[model samples]
Target: MIVIQAKLIFLNQQDKQIVLDLMRRWSSCMKFAYKRLLEGYDRKTLKRDLQGTFDLNSRYVDDAIMKARGVLESSRQLDNNPKKVIFGGRDLFGKLQKRHINGKEYQKLKTKWQERRKGNLYSRGDKSKKGNLNTRIEVKENGTFLRINVGERKYVYARIEAGYKKNKRREELLQEIAESNIPYSVELKLKNGNIYAYFAIEEEYPEIKITKEKGVIGIDINAHPGNISWTEVDEKGNLISYGNIPMPELASGSKDKKEYFRWQYAHEIVKIAKEKGKAIVIEKLDIKEKGKRGDFSGRKSRRIRHSFSYKSLLSKIKTLAKREGIEVIEVNPSYTSIIGMLKYAPQYMITKDVAAAYVIARRGLGLQEKIPDNYIKFLNALTVDELEELREHVKKTVRNKHIKKKHLREINKAMEFLQSLESKPGRVLEPLDGTSFSAYDFWRVLKVAVVTPLSPEKVKRDFSVLKELLIQGKWGGP
Candidate 1:
């Protein structure tokens, strides 16, 4: 969907007052509906009550309920308390309660808070109603104007001045809305003592032109180094090119600035795909809030978690690709990094992140990776006693460090994989005739025997150092 913002020009004071009154009533009904929804009130009963309790019509009441429910559901998704949600903003409310300012500053803040709390009105689209029922935009010979139905045959009109120069997409959408009766939603909002109208219309994406038939470009977003590493792989799963886009500014910037940078980087990525005539492949990541307060995650860990905007960047890339007619493929992220570290990083002579991107690209093309022969040999050479010794050494190492509980649990699982190897060394060391050890077993044992001995800093940054140990069987420092 595309949203167009237009400034509302009131022709007369009467029309402005009517709109203001409607907005105030709409916001009140919205707050009331939110409370009812929290109390387990269903939509049918809540809509009836809202219409009777406020001066809004049935349609407006329904819209109010939808808006309230949207806010409630969003808060719940973020694991926030519904009762503690401030309508305007928690920061402004806190300032007012604390009386942090006086005179003009305080009054200015108070007015802004009131506008945010009580100046929202919305109407859903209706194809039969000419885009919207209560709020409709009409195109006449003179100019474009918005017609608002204010109950009892009363109406208020405002001139719409959408800047076509700044947003070409909005201009095209506006032209479409004027030419055809395409369903479009409108939201009237008051910002900085001025009323603005936001129009949301469905966007028809073009057919995909670039696909994975040629190759795929895989992207890996790294938080510590603050860069996006991407690798282009041919159809035969050979690396054609690789590059990195540094985004150090994303970690510390205004929200708008950060969003602008994300869009810019997304455009860059899509441009590369278009040039190469290949589809983009990215990891399907579902990152939840982590490193909560008092979790023993240090300042650095917290910073990395907070600074990572993988979802935001990936979303922007997908949205832009859709508009540009570029096919985007999402692959499972499981073991991509580990597989890269142990296998591709050493073989390809590339950084771990780039190797991970290569793995993702190959996976997108239906390519399956097998354990390298050297890695298989390295694993098979370990005897049962050596496996037991490595497990004990890893346990002691973890016990000596300040590892998080989750990391400790992961180490314990890796140890279990080691114990399994010790218990049935014959089976695990058997020839790869369909009954040998799986790739997962090798990765887990490697984590315990090989990766666990390295320093935490080295493990996080680079894995190319493991090339010596894997190729020459050189035992590195513990």
Candidate 2:
């Protein structure tokens, strides 16, 4: 759908403050009016009542309504829905003359309302409108105009600029986005900077996917992204290799909290998947297990398990999935990660060459059907392009997750620390949680099956010689 987002900037702080104060007062008056006047309470009649109540001179309430309507129509959601009315916070005091305003002289002592931060509340008996409440005003779809009277004069800063037509300016910009095109609920992010508005579009469907299965699909959710492992059985109920995908959190750190984009991201993906006829598979976490994420395991629980919002997100995803008649399976996660898809199967069960190739090849690719034997030769002969691209994608993805930019450097440094003990045949290394790694345990793990034996005495004797160079403060860096 055609979504229009606008950012309003007050020319100066004083003007901004003035506009903000006025909006607070007007918002209260507005709520009071609506609570009293809106009985039939439906949008069509509400817009008419609000527009007629406000004074208009040099006024253009109609313009704002028209702009919003224009967007709704292009989105094709305006049918039977009333248009929206939003009041952009205003500024413009020092720049104005009495004539420019409604000819009202500046009062000797005037009070204004301001916004409340934290947990402050706006009450009726306050000295000013109190800036205590910030309210969003809405009118049902008709793509109508909005008005605010400045002594009977109204101005429109944000309004519909274009509508879609065969030759319309906005038609090319829309690019097949419409309410009908998106058949389920999802969020669309249209942004400039600083200001973002969220619109919820929900379409109810009877089923999640067109697949023939009626049984549950098991999922294994993870710290970075979620993973699903479900056994697909044949008509005879024979087990099929489970399927899994790493579902990463879509929001980036540099984004402001107020932006709140991931709900929309998750919503959109589920919506599209449903439309494409795929059952949604997700993990059900035990409350206590999910709560203590930091205790998951040795390497992962300590280092990579801290991203929040996954628990809540899974709930929302499942709710939407159920609405679409999709089956969601929650399987016991024991032995899931360490023994996953045959391709990514760990070194103990699968040989090293096979495991390395699988991790490198399928890190970014999704679950897939088996490749023919000849395809392996084709992949082996393919230039180093594949590995390089895979690293680039992983680096970019991880960077956006807000992990410290120096993380890889630190990890490499730690690896070097462990490597030093390679000469110390029986030594082990173990980094504490948050530390790169400990020296004692990890070094021991590496001390095995050496084609050529190394001297343990070399490490005990020479390791102290390199300690200073090995560390960057308490953290290690190569």
* C-alpha lDDT values of all predictions: 0.77, 0.32
Superposed by TM-score, candidate 2 places the C-alpha of residue 298 at a distance from the truth, in angstroms, of 5.8
Q: Count the backbone clashes (under 3 Å) in each candidate.
A: 0, 32
lDDT of model 2 at position 24 = 42
Q: Give the per-residue lDDT of model 2 (tens digit) for 1-88.
A: 3343323333345543443444443444344333433233444454555555543211122232333344444445535322232222
Alpha-carbon TM-score of each model against the true structure: 0.56, 0.32
- In model 1, the worst 10-residue window by lDDT is 429-438
Which residue segments of model 2 deviate by more than 4 Å?
1-50, 53-261, 276-278, 290-304, 307-309, 338-478
- What C-alpha lDDT, on a 0 to 100 scale, does residue 412 get in candidate 2? 41
Residue 146 of model 1, lDDT score: 87
